[model samples]
Target: MTVSVLVPSSLTREAEDKREATRKLGYVARAAAVFRVDRLVVFPDSGAEGRWGDGFVETVLRYAATPPYLRKEAWGKRDELEYAGVLPPLRVASRTGSGSDDSGSLRQGIVTEVGSDGRVRVNCGLQHPISLPEPDEGLTEGERVSIRVSSRRPVRAKFVDESPPGFVVEASDLSTELSRDDAGVRIATSRHGEQLSVDRLGDIVADTAPRGTTVAFGAPERGLPEILGVAPPGGDEGGAETERERTDLPADEPDGSRFDLWLNAVPNQGSEVVRTEEAMFAVLACLSLTE
Candidate 1:
């Protein structure tokens, strides 16, 4: 099953400095990798956006998602990646295999050149770029592709019709992300949402496992209801009145109703505040549990 995680661009809003912010994003990346998340999306959170914006969040997440070897090729020099060194290692499964010939390990490759002879030059984390015939039509240079190496001694490999091993990063608004056709079982996590009981979690996982899952998170200080301009449950009497002044949130639907489920995954919180990175680990750990 495919799992997508959505985090607000203002995730690091509470960070004391860029170094701390980068470190926080590192843990977030590590959590996503540990949970085998397929996609990590950065949604806009203008209200809570601090010094860093979407570009910084996307840059760090994209860099963290990229394999250590492919990082130089995928991204060169960027001003936004100042503290990338602090990002934790994902140690993705695909990167752990022995590079021996018969390992049949899948590796990510960048199409360096597409020749007229139906052959393409791919740099698949090898000592040198290898030229292999196109496995399918419409291959182009700079396009990322997956390949499996059968023999590394003689450099034998084939393009595979599969996604590469790591999760991809994307930046978009919450509405657009949730509206995607493949965004199955959209869940919004917040402290004020319905408390997730053991009985309810089983049903949630069972229903979400087959079709895929897309889980959204809020910022450091801002919750989903605040970001979406939806009044929280048992909010103040003027909550709706205040929310209506901010955005065009529909009056009929309850606050955060756009999501299939609004879960208070961390009920009885120990701390007064939960950091975004910390929440990612806690929530994904519970939701990813399999029977």
Candidate 2:
């Protein structure tokens, strides 16, 4: 399934310092990798941001998502990545079957310099930048592209038309991402949504696996209900249940709602508040069980 994960840019607002914030995003990146997310979108939540703000959040996340070999070339020195050292390594899984590591594999690279002739210099995590002919679509400096590496001893590689391993990172507006034609089953995760149970697993997997799914999450303490200004389930009562609660929302049928389901993926949450990274694992672990 084509999974898309959305996190508010104010995700690190509750962190005590840059190190803490950067570390938190590390786990978030790990969650994306573990779940094989296709796109990790950072939606704007500027009003609730801290001193780091969205810029810091975006920069660090982008840096973390970059493959280790291409990192130095892709992202040079940046004030926003001061605490990037705290980020945990994201060991994105390998592709099996036909394009397995045994055979030639595709790797993501950043164009260091575009040549005037018909070639461009790319840093694909080799000893040095290599030269290759530009694609029919052409290439630009700083543009990321996929390269097929056949042999490392002789350094045989070429640019190819395909996505490399690992999830992509980008920033976007919540509405726009949710509105995408391929957004699949949109889910908003909160502590006050429908509780998920084993009985419902079959239906959810059958429904979302084929169509793909897009899941949105909020910052620490700021649940999806608060982010979208929607009252949590039973908000009028003593309070909404701290479990997997849900609401009906269909992408094709946008009933003035931001998501197709307001899902409390983690039911009977023992912790008073689940960090965004923790929530990602708890929520996605269940969703990942799809064909």
Candidate 3:
């Protein structure tokens, strides 16, 4: 299933420094990679943005998701990437074995040249670019493609009609993101939302697993209700209330956001607060469960 994770641009609002901000973003990227998320979206939260805004968060997240070998080619020098050094690596599932194996290994490659003779030179993290017969559907230079390598000695490989591994980072507003054609089961995670119990999670997964899933997380301090200008259950300013106590508040009204459900993924938290990165891991872990 396609899984899209949404985090506010003010995700690092709690970070004290650039280094810590970058490190926190690394864990977010790692969580996305671990869950095999299809898209990592950064929604605007201008009010809560700290020193760095969406630009910094998007740049760091995109950099962290890109494979080390493809970083230089994918993104060149940029002023927004000054703190890139502090970004931790996301060891995503990509081609690991050398092309020596006969069974073939899946690898992502960028087209360097598309020859008239139906051949294209691809650089798939190899010592040298390899020339292979292009697929019937033509290819263009700078286009990313997937290839399966059968042998390294002679470099036997062929193009595979499949999506490349890892997720793509994007920046968009919450409304626009939810309006996408592929946007499915739009869930908003909050500490004051409906308590996600074991019995309820099954129905949630069943409903969302078919089309896809888009789960949104709030900032460290500001939650979705505040970000969206809606009064959270049991008032907007206070410590998190127990699930039983929250049920007594008024039901959630459509706050102009397209969220299908507001879920409290961590129902019985021992701590007073949950960081965005921590919430990402916890919420995704629960949603990723299968029947």
Candidate 4:
């Protein structure tokens, strides 16, 4: 599926930094905003369900000459977080609430580079390049935000940042949560929420086969040791959850579509891979459109 390239306000500062870095390096880093298709599920546009046919893949690869910054401030914070402190940390809840209550506005920009795994470097001009806003400080970083068309000048979005990414009303399907909203279908967590419109979502599926209805909470291949208790002593045999096992599709869908889409794009099976976020977006965009 294809994830649309969007320049959020969060990366403005990073874009400035990249520009400066490029200037120092004796060249301007041109950036363009573009989406990277991670998985294609139901793309009627072209190709099979599991892969982004050569044509679509080329389209994603050639969308922009340079990578645009499509990330948020919290990305840096999460990466830089050190496990040094052992004491109880100060926790701050937003009085403004999880959803945008004037927390801040996002500026847009372009991308500067596109890696093989679909990581694109975007460039947005943020005010300061100093300390980034901290997540625990009530400042949401590039946290997953679900933005939907509300009206001419207004957009509606829900800010969620606490629950895992799946609905667990029943004991059987605790692995994921899918929320249907005006924006389309959102597979999000209590913590990070991503918005996917119908068109964008459909594009992704037609391009990349999605593993199933539920996005990967954490793929089985990359399953962590302990959770609320999904795994047992020996845990999975690494490749236990086959491509077919991972999907929630009914019979009649194409073979290998669900497995390749979600497993490869969404989860990292210990390899140095591309950003799973991009893949997640592709599938989500499809679900949203279909819903």
Candidate 5:
């Protein structure tokens, strides 16, 4: 099952500094890798942008998502990744066959050169770029491709039709992502949305797993309702209410617009504030489970 996770560019709005922001983004990347997300979209939230806007968020996420072997060549020195040292390792294991077998392991490669002789030079973090037979339609210079490496000693590898081991980072408009054709079971997560229950989660996973799903999350203090200008449940009421009361949301119809199902991933909570990264783990733990 394919899963696409959409996070606002203002995700680090609550961060106290650049270092802290980078650390927070690391966990977000960790969640994506843990859940095997196909896409990690950083949607624009111009109004709520801070010292770190779309550029910073996108750059850091892209850097974090890049495989360790290709990082140096894929992304050169950049100001946005100043605190990249603190980012946690994702450790997304290779899904290709194991043992000393000919099936080979999957590795990400960058096309350094495309030749007229139906061959292309790929840099898959080897000692040097290697040239392999061109793909059916041919590949372009600078295009990222996957290679299946059977023998590293003699360097036997071939281009393969597949994605790398980690989630791909993307920057997109919020509206554009919501309208995609493959955007199956669009879910908006919020404290004021419907409360998530054990029974409900099983149904959601079973139903949506086959078709794929897209889930959107809001930044701290600024939720999807606030971002979309849709009134939040309890309607600007005071914050002294309990979690049970906050999750006592209205019926499931997108909370008026945009989403297919509105959800309160954590129904009961002792902490009044739930950070975006925290909520991500809480929500995805239930959603991405397989039988």
Candidate 6:
């Protein structure tokens, strides 16, 4: 079997955008390897117009040229995708105000460092200093601590205090620490999942940036199961241990070949591709079960 790369011109307009598109294509290629996909398609989308800083197609080629995870396989054909999906516009909202409450709140800050001592310092962009929360009842320094902060008003922030209250709990308390540096300051984003550095957006560090922005892109073929190094859903004895790997997703088709072929024709719920990615994913998942 052979593997292929797909690049939609619409996704890549500038040098950076083009590069990103290539990376996405490479990701798909890698996913294809995992799923053993043959005859991949490269479709270009020209949804982007004069807004592109540099030539979109050229930019995509530059970015795509970078070796992706699945670069091991050589891409074959190149085509144009008539319509994939309508990607929403990018909106960056300003952070202002100070007064805050529960109804309307969000966490804002700049991550300074991931401490070797197990403490994270964040500059909440507030005038006051917020205290760090106890990692866990038994959390010690050098241990990873997760924190979640939300903006109350514009400038004011309310740290989600998950710390177990000591005998003497107060109405107002700090959950994380902050410090000033040459670059500017450091602040915590959230502690529950991955500890993100809000100080840096994209690849560089900046003092002021939008609280957060969502980007729409194709989902990686290798998902949680692969990252965790687990086998597909069939309860493979040689797979890693994860809840998702053990569960079977609802499939639109049952027969392995027909289902897989059918799915390839649809786009996902969000994307307008003929066959939804979700359906294909569903079929792939069932195939994994049998594997």
Candidate with top TM-score is: 2
lDDT: which is higher, 4 or 5?
A: 5
Cα distance off (Å), candidate 3, residue 269: 2.3
Q: Is candidate 1 or candidate 5 better by TM-score?
A: 5
Off by over 4 Å in 1: 95-103, 115-118, 234-249, 252-257
TM-score, prediction 1: 0.86
Instruction: Return whichever of 3 and 6 wins on lDDT.
Output: 3
Question: Tens digits of per-residue lDDT for model 2 on 1-291?
Answer: 689999998899988888888899999999999888999999888788877684777788889999988777778888888878888999875542355443576788888888889899998888888888888898889998888877788887877667888888889988889888899998878777667788776777777898999999999878777777656765523233421233422335344346666677778879888889999999899988844
Clashes found in each candidate (C-alpha, N, C closer than 3 A): 0, 8, 1, 53, 0, 43
Model 6 vs truth, CA RMSD: 21.5
Better of 2 and 5 by TM-score: 2
Instruction: Tell how far residue 150 is off in model 1, in angstroms.
Output: 1.5
Query: In lDDT terms, how accurate is model 5?
Result: 0.83
lDDT of residue 80 for candidate 1 = 74
Task: Tell me the tens digit of each residue's lDDT in model 5 across 20-104.
Answer: 9999999999999998899999988886968888489899999999988888888889989889999999999986775665377
Worst 10 residues of 2 by lDDT: 236-245
Sliding window of 10 residues with minimal summed lDDT for model 3:
236-245
Please provide TM-scores, in order, for all candidate models, with all chains considered together.
0.86, 0.89, 0.82, 0.20, 0.87, 0.22
lDDT by residue for model 4 (1-291), tens: 222221111111222233332221111001111122222111122212122222322222222111123323322322111211221211211123345453333333333343444343333333322122222323222333321212223323222343211111111122221221111112221111122334444554544344333333332122211112222212222232333444334456443222222222233235443222334444344444443
Residues 130-214, model 1: lDDT tens digits? 9998876768888888888877898878887777787999888777877778888888787776677789789888889788888
Rank order by TM-score, top first?
Answer: 2, 5, 1, 3, 6, 4
Candidate 5 Cα misplacement greater than 4 A, ranges: 97-102, 115-118, 233-257
If both were scored by TM-score, which would come out higher, candidate 5 or candidate 6? 5
- What candidate 6 gets wrong by more than 4 Å, as runs, is 1-101, 108-120, 123-158, 161-291
Backbone clash total for model 4 is 53
